[model samples]
Target: MVVFKKFNLDKQSIEVPGTRVQGATGHYRHASYVNGLVEHIAEAPHIKTLYDLFQNSVTKYGDREFLGHRPYNTVAQTYSGYTWQTYAQINQRVNAFGSGLMHLNEVILQNPQLNRWSLGIWALGRPEWYISEMSCNFFNLVSVALYDTLGPDAVEYIVGHAEIPVIVCSGNHVSTLLQNASQMPGLRAIISMDSLQDTVPVPGATSPAKILRAWGEEKGIKVFDFDEIENFGAEFPRKHLPPLEDEVASLCYTSGTTGQPKGAMLTHKNFVATVATNREGLSIYLPLAHIYGRVVDTNATFSGCKIGYFRGDVALLMEDIQELRPTFFPTVPRLLNRIYAKIVASTIEAPGLVGALSRHAVATKLANLEAGKGVHHPLWDRLLFNKIKMALGGRVEVLLTGSAPIAKEVLNFMRIAFCCVVTEGYGATEGMATATVTLSDEYIPGHVGCPRAGCEIKLVDVPEMNYLVTDKPYPRGEIHIRGATVFKGYFKDEKNTRDTVDSEGWLASGDIGFVDNRGCFTIIDRKKNIFKLAQGEYIAPEKIENILMARCNLIQQIYVDGNSLESTLVTVVVPEPETFLPFANAITGSQVGLGDNVGLAKLCRNPQVNAAFLKELDKAGQAGGLRGFEFVKRMHLTTDAFTVENGMMTPTFKVRRPQVSAHFREQVQAMYADIHASTPAAKL
Candidate 1:
């Protein structure tokens, strides 16, 4: 029952992947599976809950490094390298933290919500974050995650609705909690990860300690440092209250602008059954508020793997990775795309016969990638791509990316360049990070591989989009997921839960994709964020944008917005520095590069450059098979990248259309106005 094929790297070769599930289809119509219904491939049958998983790991691997983080020096205002905590140390703290929450102030023991008190964790991925989350599982309390970047308004809604009486948060988040503390009637206490004397104030922001003292006093809510709670719990110990398999372990709130956030209820069984599976220290970076991050951490902990946190600085992220030397690298496409661009740009700048050799090596490796070799070339890997491989720690054996669709070319480029298993996963928050990840053995470029173990995927027809199961080439429809991996329901959201997961338990994924001949799914369109033009052509901007990105590396991120009353479309693009800067300098006869923000910002709005860039976009779109109506009629170029902080992008790097539209409303209107004045100029 070995799920993975054993390999001997000494032989200079790795085992093939996903071979056990080749050509596997499911019982349901258009359904797909990695290994079908034959036991889900999860070997840890005894691990029924996160509580059990941790206990087992602690018993077996007590001396092993459980979690590690870089200590930020307040005096020097810089971070040192990683400091680790052993499994035994972490286990002791987990007990103390859970004990305090349950025994003191009757936190979970008398929640008044069936003794199922909900604790809120609002922070990035850190030791304290993971500890508090695990404490909830150990004590049978529900851990509710507030999106790391959510403002006071959304946090207020989630806090009030979930009736979270106590919130464990990072120092920076204390100010946000204080903003609406009075509105949260059920809230009784706040636990800050940093000490009041030590909480450093961010630029232009009030001190967290001051807000805590002021607001906590005014609201009659108790405030305690994270260490205080742990010490208190140790002093007044309580017995562990492990959860039942069916009990909800977490209340994860979904982020969107459509309506109030709906909490996705994930049970111990739902999670334990799926995870029970990872690597051998994960270089963690994704937010723990996300299911992807949480589950990855869960899997890593279960396997007794060390987890390292980034130094909380995006600028020095690569430096942290270089120091950590992680064997497994898990990240989102946005980050990987940046890394890919840097490598490609470096190859382009190599002056001499070296440049020609690099180009030839790229072509040869790409050909090898298409043939299912998968990041392996006896000659090229060690000789040509060793430096690129070393960039991600010199020991990265696995590379996984998810959250949004990655450019096909980028996917292939990464596979060849990283010299590792480069995979892309597809899933959503509601799915409990439910996914279909590409197999390392699969040579396919655009497809997210077949259904993962413990889950099943099917396609339901969307008539308006002209997608149906009966269509040829492949069946096209809305993606539906069902199985142990999917969330049971949304907390207290019966209507939404019912709407999302029908009687059959198939969770309607709102996304559109088609099952390929290999039983893989290539995400094509989304049901939401779709609009019809005045002449009546439905356009999936994401599909169009993905096409543009695959064909044109110059375009970093693109947003195509159109008025239903208008006959044409317009776009705002964030271009890659390496690709766009050279193009810009060539056309404008001016030299501008990264770090010259003022010059780059001004060049982004140059009319001549914008006009020329539009034609370049046209050529790319045409190459990707875009029709005349689908072509972008006008475009605005931007040096500014959309981000979660700007409210223009999601954590997963997908642009929030509503936010993007609002931010660019004036620019969008101006583009439309110009298009209207040049009515005769519109063409493919």
Candidate 2:
């Protein structure tokens, strides 16, 4: 059993029934219950690898539905049907697929010239994607996940760098790969998940097999349908599955914020450890290409929880939620913020007594929650909170949000509104999706709870930025993590890997945060993102950006940029349409109609409107307790929301700073030039 460090909740720690307490010495690094679970997992002899976990789950729940997906026509926007596979059924497919892959490997090994072979998958949340991934695991072939949103260039770079021999992809991805096939010399075969005729067909097209045959002949690469491989495997009985130890399992590429993306090498042991520390029951909506989604899927599968996939369209997520009524929902801050904004808007704008009662209920519930009282009042629970719960499918027991820091108000509102435990975790691609997760009972606003089980965390002082562990009340510094869940290293990048993971086996997170009395961590800023201004004050743009977007209703999205040469900050703002339109109309004394892109663009550049927006920024800054240098001094408002297609946001929804900066290069230059020309900055 692992002996965990202890922390004192108070000088005299008292244990309540059904609640575990950290030690009285105030030294425990992990939650008590989490430590118990980790120790239990460590002691279990059968749970050694991810495959082992899956086998165990199959043994326990063979007849239960393991995976589910909604089938719909993309163009028609009509639901065709729904499909589910039981654990036993899925096991049969995985075994057959694994055997087929082994057969393919045998063929490759017979060649004298070939030394390495791997497979890639680029598709959405479909059964084929899951089967392919599992088959790779069973056959000991390295699985490379290709994001569906990746452009042709990025896809080529990743495919060539990884030297992928076979690719199983959807129709759109097939077209992308075909465009750059000449650039990828290592690619051998292409398997279409959908019918080739439906995916890529000529007018008066022939059969899918013939079309694929013709295309394959032209490209000099073999092409097959998804069913062909399965059928090939079905000719033989399932092969004996073996447990894998520390072998490299998957190569998940990082979202390239600096330059080209690097593949992170995640081993089977790393995944087993991560899943061992996880709780069950999560509705997986995040793309599987992301580490966050992968961890959730693995954990849910291992824990024998029924996993549900959303319809391809994200706009229809609520519909899926209502249909599935999942017990837990894993989400990111972006979606939660939008939900909060919409609910607040609807409540305030509701007509007559209905709106008044809604407002009163929210206010009462919030007040009670702050005072450490029950969240549900009998009257309010029926009239307001119950309806709110129904909207979230009515069965949500816990809501987990991560990938970014949510506003404290939004966090608190979610807890009260849903009357469920809302947890916020901190993780990165390097850490296998989680380092710290908030406990159910410990719902501090901005703090991601204690270090996870089997993970040891320590802070190193960065005096240059004035962060120190010896600070009063709370100790602050750069967080370094050491754990089994950390990735092995960056694939084939020894120098970068050495720089990331130190000689002491500690991975420098590059994130600066502080620990409070309860051993909870509150992230302040990122070390790389911190910039010093000409006036000698350091500014963390992400910290300020979160504050602004969380507090200001008119601001939908923002990118705060500053340089060492400039004393003040500048921002590119994507305004909230509903909020900005009304505000703009009041200023112009004329109704600005909705969907008027040209008029909105002109309004964004108007001097009077800009001045008012500056005041709004000042108000938001004051509300967030921001420093003087943290306030936005100049701004450019755009009607366009940053999206993945525009190269402004990552697939995981993180703002791409360099890309956004480059796209708005002219506006940024003009903002700086105005300041240099002695044009007074917007009055804050």
Candidate 3:
């Protein structure tokens, strides 16, 4: 039996419903509930695999559009349209693709020694990627995913590690694989999604198909176009090798921020269980190569919901949303942050009365929400909020954000602006994308709600960094999770697998968080990311970074660093130039205009401007109630923000700390060098 603890903020008290269970590890296990029901693992005995989920959905919603794609014009070399496939059509393609893989497997099995084969998809978000993935599960072949942005070396590593014999990829990916083909001995075939006849010729080469064919002939490998496989499969009998619930459905690779990417083996049961506990109806925008996006896609398919694909260009996502009019939008914090920044900028730039009215309407709505009253301002809703809602296609009833923590202000603003329920989820690749999620009606700021139906969560003390379960206000420690949603293990790495998951099945999340008396969890910082200074004061850079970002509008991006040799913290800030321009001008009492790169760079190093920013930083730190050592004592401002193309941010929009540190090594050293200097440090 599970017990629930309820916390009343107004009363400043906690009420536990049932007796607590003390584990042998000296940790307390307190189960929680939402809407009076204790969370327990969702049971789905009928659904055994991804194939079963798809079949069930096809039976229920065969005529509905299940997948969408944007078509490209061959002559003009531009995308001018969108198309969709019904559930029935999707089933047909999946069956044909599966049958084709089965036929290929038979051909490969003629050797009589090899018992298993793997299929790899190395493409962007497209219909064929979905078909190929499902086909692998359908034919009982292992499915391996390769990131489109991966370099030649990472590609070779993943291909060799998975022992993938066949790969389905786009033209660009074919070029990459061709470059590293000699290194990947097990890879035998390449399936191009685009037909050779329709593909445009690369600058210095013939058509990609011709190049691939010549290369394959040279390397003793076979290459096939997408249509050929479908046609061949149409002639062959369908193969029906059902996958077991415990069988590995897909091998998802980590983002490889610290080192070589490790594949997390996600079982069919893991996916099915995730879908069973998920809500339906979402427009897919995230990359399918990632587990977070893939789980959402699979869940939408399993729940008989229409999934609209974004145009390859992410800049056009808002336009796609306007066209698709999806009822649910699954997103990350970066996109939401951009949306918030754009809205604020546009509203501020609006001329005269328009700007005043927009600001007033937003302020009124936010006040109403904060006061625990209904947002029923009809006049404001019609004039302001309704237009805001229309920007998201006017049909979205729920918004889900995860992958990173979002600002409380942004989350609240979006809810009121869209007139919908916005929920945050907490999960990772190791946990199949979800271990806990916020309930529909539970609107607690900064809290990621309780554990999901199928998950159990607990906290363990980390004494080295001074995090303990008995901390004041709320218990703070490292979070550990155990559930059906947790992945099996890392593929082909027993040592890493053993290190990640313990004998009792609990996987350490590496995230330091605290559970509120109400069971709502709030993540503080990553355990591994915490560093101790020369004075033995532990610092959680992410915690300080989030606070500074939330409190300071001028800070677009920030990275905090400390070392055992240093007693004070140092920071690198990417300032919002538009916001910083006014501050700089105000500090100097002169109009320092934007777009003059040299002038802006000088302004970033200006003594007066730095002093003002340091004051702002100090205020923000004070507001966040940080210790004196946690506040940044030395800082440098850079105009360029961390970005994926620059290798400073991951594809998922997380700051690659190692990369950022390396890129800013000189600046870091300069900051430390000036620690004892007589000169005042530049601080922004």
lDDT of 2 by residue, 48-163 (tens): 66677778878977997778777778789877544678889998898877676555545532423332256889987777788888877666678898974444566788888888
lDDT ranking from best candidate downward: 1, 3, 2
Task: Report, for every candidate in turn, its global Cα lDDT versus the true structure.
Answer: 0.74, 0.72, 0.73
CA shift of 456, model 2, Å: 1.4
- For every candidate structure, what is the RMSD over all alpha carbons to the true structure, in angstroms? 13.0, 12.5, 12.3
Q: Ten residues in a row with the worst lDDT in model 2?
A: 283-292
| Clashing pairs in model 1, backbone N/Cα/C closer than 3 A | none
Candidate 2 at residue 191, lDDT?
79
Cα-based lDDT at residue 607, candidate 2: 87
C-alpha TM-scores of all predictions? 0.73, 0.73, 0.73
For model 3, the stretches where C-alpha displacement exceeds 4 angstroms are: 1-44, 76-81, 108-116, 198-207, 279-292, 348-351, 374-376, 530-684
Runs in model 1 lying further than 4 Å from the true structure: 1-3, 6-42, 107-114, 198-211, 276-292, 530-684
Clashes (backbone N, CA, C under 3 Å), per candidate, total: 0, 6, 0
Clashing pairs in 2: 5-28, 6-27, 6-28, 7-26, 7-28, 8-26
Query: How well does candidate 1 score on lDDT at residue 266?
Result: 89
